[model samples]
Target chain A: MTGQSPIVYPGRMSRWEPQARERLVRAAVELFDEHGYDSTTVVQIAQRAGLTKSTFFRHFPDKREVLFAGQDVLCELLAGGIDAAPDEATPLSAVAAGLEAAAGNFTPELHAIGPALRAVVESNSDLREREALKHHSFADAMTLALRRRGIADPAAGLAAWLGVLAFTDAYACWIDPACDQELTALLRLKLRELRAAISSLD
Target chain B: MTGQSPIVYPGRMSRWEPQARERLVRAAVELFDEHGYDSTTVVQIAQRAGLTKSTFFRHFPDKREVLFAGQDVLCELLAGGIDAAPDEATPLSAVAAGLEAAAGNFTPELHAIGPALRAVVESNSDLREREALKHHSFADAMTLALRRRGIADPAAGLAAWLGVLAFTDAYACWIDPACDQELTALLRLKLRELRAAISSLD
Candidate 1:
């Protein structure tokens, strides 16, 4: 029987030299695209990054963690945003703000990595489950934030899940050259449409 | 690389052996519960059913498929329900009808297998991704059904996703004895609450 990996504290330490970490992620992402996800080994990724296998192990406990670099930071920012929203904003607005705050990390370089991210997510079952778990975590965090604000009949979990899906779908559409809409504007439109669609269900 | 399992054609088989199939499923479910999903093998399951490993494979391609036996059939039924729903019914209502039809497969005996099903989904990333993919397929099926019914908007995809999530959440609540609500009634309440939540976003 295969043993479950020990749980490491996520994003806790600056485990590797910054340059080495960046190189590892870049090389892994590129290799994931070129050779495919299951075929790309940790050794290959480390070698491509010009680092020893030991250094790669030092930075990431496993293969999947490399693909999800910076997720912990994103979650922390989302938590903060949800907590800091002013009294005037609706629950959905607070969630939107939190997501917007997190969106700053989707830099030009990260955006260029979109197809690779989707490919890895699509190919690996574990990656998809981890992604779903992350989404659930964000929803749980949002629910707690909403509960703190005393909003009765908490739909925070459902709302958070829907909002994330909307953002993801809209982001995918916006980034396509054929879509002809900027990401920022498209996200706003998507949010508005999602709100409307939800309203229609009522 | 592992070869894909051969697709079994139903026409080549004799008249449906419901009793044997049911016995096999019962034995598999019991084994899955006692030993956990990964630890249970085809040989053990077959012995429990008083059948052979060859017979078990003849019925199901693998262990995971045993848990997902009704998924395709349910997807088809839900898709058909959506297609046949009255034009005056709201999109939510249509989706709800489809969900009810899908959930119709949940017999009293099947409820006993809930823990094992959830365990399989939780422990295996590949299984989890396949679940997501199955949901995606059902959503696409619903979208096509809605489009044929003359729904006009970018809301088709979003609505299908939300509808499925509502069904899923309600189903989870239903199987938990601690929840103490009838599945049908709980589903109705969930859809109503979901509608209210969606409308509030406006």
Candidate 2:
């Protein structure tokens, strides 16, 4: 929760980090696929991305972060959206708004690279763990926001977990080659389905 | 999920692993508190536990594995419990049964050293990631078990995540100085409370 979070804020990405981050991720994944994950180096990724090693670290904490580049900004958007949700909104709507906010961070490049990134991630256990950590971070960010909204212990945490499931499902759809829906619409639908499924579990 | 999981099975612990594991954890935490996590060595931990270095490795995959001993066994119990739940049991009950299976791994020695282990874990980020991974592993274990029980994608994953939150809450209480209930009881109550709170979220 402390060391792992959004390294930069919203609008900060407008300052040049986003394009650099994208290049780094694309370069890192290319290196991973071509040279094997273990054989690839940050220096190589930076060289490939046409950025310095320091610039690579400036955008990503490590090489594994290549596929997970937009996470920090995504997390910040989640909390910010939740925080900015209208007064008297239910937790579900608040989370949905957060998802909508996060949807803005999903670029056409991210969507285009999704399949390849998934392939590279699925090929490695370390990358998978980092992926899990990323989802966990999203939940943590949402949980904190929900708590701030006066949602109590199990409920805030539960809603946050549900938000993560929704986010995961929506991302899965958004990445599919056949899917045409925007992430915002998919997230709202997935979250609504989660809300419905909550009652079905009993 | 593969590289980071319970290293041993249930009855497998009968053959000198549990005692060795306990000794190793106690020793490791002691060393972590005294010499700091970076300064501690596997050989030194083995020395403090009065066992060979290989014996320490036999019980744990790495130094970080020391604080998270018995996780593999707990995961097995979770899956086993879910598998053994009655044919008509609801997913909630099935998860409860899984948690009940996991409760057997919480030894008095674990309870006694809970605070120290937690303190040691809280002191470091890498260890915290390891701890988070351990919880994520538990959810993975349960999700697989629920899938075996005919539960579908988002439902299985969501149910497993709820079980984790309850397990987390129950563990928090179990580690408290004032908590006297069995982990099984605490887990059941927590899970039931989660069920009730699910509807309250909206």
Candidate 3:
């Protein structure tokens, strides 16, 4: 699905010309949403964005990259959020702060982004594989955050990965009709449930 | 990359035709490993197995399905192993029994499989996706087993997934030249470490 509208931000946020970036993302999400990922093209997105092909290329390398325009920013926020947590915070606690930051970063304007993103991601095999790769990247980042607190073990990597899954699953549940909890509360609840499940194993 | 050669029963197993299954798996793995997945042909695999392409088709529906030749047997064995565990056993204990049964199912005859299977799966996106789907299927089977035991939350799905990952990560580590732990021991050690990691969070 095409992302948000092409808002022509004035001054400071004019890094790449917000209007063009916004148009590209918006057109991409719409195109992906309507026609599906494999069928969508950069040319069509550019056409829908009222821009030349060159302008679209200047804003995004390809159509798929347009949907993930803010991934780097999100990753930075997550990393910073985790690092800023208290030194004595548990791994999941640090990860919870990071996840909360991530949730907050997605403003109300981007509320529909989750399913739109998942639709495009699930339809393509390369994109799905990359989703797994991105998860691995996030887990690696979380592990580095834990290492800063002197938590050393191969288990650090596994725990970070499990933490991500718990948070992601909670987010999924939050968006589901069956779940009544808000995203933040749902994450805490899922983490508690996950902890209980794991603890009961021993 | 290929599974075990079929076990030749003295008389009782003769009706099962282990030799035919072994020939099919061996030929398929050899072709998939050497020529690569896309480049390899069912005709070639059949020729390598001294059979017709129709014979290969009889054994497998498609080229990718050959990679999962014994999945049904593995899933059955895994479910049965979990179900056979004592009612007093903890969830982790039950899951561990299933994992151990799976490991036992893939014997020394399949020792060279880890990297070869990984290579094929990694090289082909469809096969790579199939890996996750297969894991999900196994998780579902495990979840059903847990439900039969009156486990309250189907969050057992998450636990099943994490348990599988722990098994996979530990197995991967065991096969890595840098790791000194035996495969079986590493499985238990990883589970022990996982228990510690979760408890530490609480």
Best by lDDT: 2
Candidate 2 — which residues are off by over 4 angstroms?
A: A1-18, B1-18
What would the DockQ be for model 1? 0.34
lDDT of 2 at A80: 95
TM-score of each predicted structure versus truth: 0.82, 0.89, 0.73
The 10-residue segment with the lowest total lDDT in model 2 chain B? B9-18
Over the stretch B1-202, how does candidate 2's per-residue lDDT look in tens digits? 3555446556435354557878988899889888988899999999999887877877788888888777888999999999999998878789899999889888898898888888888888667767777888999999999999998877788889899999999999999999899898899889988998888777
Per TM-score, the best of the predicted structures is 2
Model 2: per-residue lDDT, tens digit, A1-202? Answer: 3555446666424354557777888888888888988999999999999877877877677888777777888999999999999988888889988889999988898898887788788898667767887888999999999999998888888988899989989999999999999999999889888887787677
Q: Which parts of model 1 have CA positions greater than 4 angstroms off?
A: A1-16, A123-134, A152-154, A177-182, B1-24, B119-137, B178-181
lDDT of 3 by residue, B1-202 (tens): 1465445456422344445556767787788899888898888887887876755665788778878776777677667877888999777777777777776666554555656767788787667657666665676677777777666553566556556666767778866656766666777777777766666663
Per-residue lDDT of candidate 1, residues A22-118 (tens digit):
6788889899889988899999999998887877888788777888787777777666777788888787887777777777766666666767777
Choose the strongest candidate by DockQ. 2
Clashes of each: 0, 2, 7
Ranking by DockQ: 2, 1, 3
- Which residue pairs does candidate 3 place in steric collision? A1-A29, A1-A30, A1-A33, A2-A26, A2-A29, A2-A30, A3-A26
